[model samples]
Target: MQQNKNDLQTTNKTKDSERIPAIRMFNLEDESSAFEIGSIPILMPTDATSFWASNKTEDWEQKMHPAPRKQYVVTIKGKLKFTVSDGSTFILEPGIILLAEDTIGEGHSWEIIDGNEWIRLYIPLSADADDHFIAENIG
Candidate 1:
């Protein structure tokens, strides 16, 4: 049997890295549109529901739930400003990624900074049915 070099490299990197494994089953760039932006599911845990959030900002504002799962946001264009309940604000720029664990407390809101584009990937605490199965229907 023949093995590909890139595959071997990826395997080696996975084994060497101490961080969470990277799953690239979905692409955000394909979902962009001029109006009515939307999101898609990328990597879903076996016992949880995971999906992506993509939208365009044009002086639009909204409040968001803390969510029962973890969240990872990556800005593709413009800027995004998040104001937490504690009165601290966070700004996300292009090519930057932000991760919010499920353990974090609630009270968070988001807004577009000067009509920017925002894309977010959500990972649930439990696994999805396709990813894996929990014992005794715990999920």
Candidate 2:
């Protein structure tokens, strides 16, 4: 018996998954905080429900603050320098995804970088599925 090329290819096949960058926020009883990660919110459509876009000139200086809602941010253009409460900083460029959820106390600060224009998408979380993320370790 001879082995076909398809058989050989199938035997060597590999499974690949998509992992997006994210900045997770937590609303503690006393204060709010944020963290950065390279992976987040399983690649499913149930949790992420709504989305909006922000396209504007990147010339504003935002102080430490929390996100207005629990959502995901997907960068489409330009860059942003984010600094968390832990004194950590991250530079986000195009194709980076950030999950912003710290809607409680002290959040994070960010400033536009690299260019004068920035575009991104804001995806809100589903109320029911939001709890799932709250209890799970996504990092």
Candidate 3:
């Protein structure tokens, strides 16, 4: 009986190890002029979840949905310029991270200054039972 229980625990650990890691990337469709262009993953957790290492770059301009949960933006690469709805701008560089509350309003904007390359990990405020956490929290 003890051996059977040990086997069951090992099996559960293997199953947990098989769980997917939530890391994603966005790519530009065309290599034309600097325009509002980037890719967003289709599968994003809603509640307080966490992302490992992710990267994004945009030559033009773009907006990020205010996080449904508080967010930590960690920059792993080039410069990223952020503009909030209140007409405030922040420039972030590599090895820098910022924390902000998920608030409602006009939202925030991003632009790549001097060619932007940023790696970030997003930790959501709730558990990700499903992707529905994002919908339930943001919407």
Can you give the lDDT of residue 40 in candidate 1?
Answer: 26
What Cα-based lDDT does every candidate model obtain? 0.44, 0.67, 0.46
Taking the tens digit of each residue's C-alpha lDDT, what string does model 2 give over 19-45?
444556565666757564545435555
Misplaced by over 4 Å in model 3 are 1-49, 57-61, 125-139
Lowest summed lDDT window (length 10), candidate 2: 12-21
The TM-score values for the models, in the order shown, are 0.42, 0.69, 0.46
TM-score of 3: 0.46
* 24 Cα displacement, candidate 1 (Å): 21
Q: Taking the tens digit of each residue's C-alpha lDDT, what string does model 3 give over 1-139?
A: 2568889999978754543222111112331111121122334444554566667445333765443444545566767676655455667665444444434444456776866355666554443233321111222
Instruction: Return whichever of 1 and 3 wins on lDDT.
Output: 3
lDDT of 3 at 50: 53
Candidate that scores best on lDDT = 2
- The prediction achieving the highest TM-score against the true structure is 2
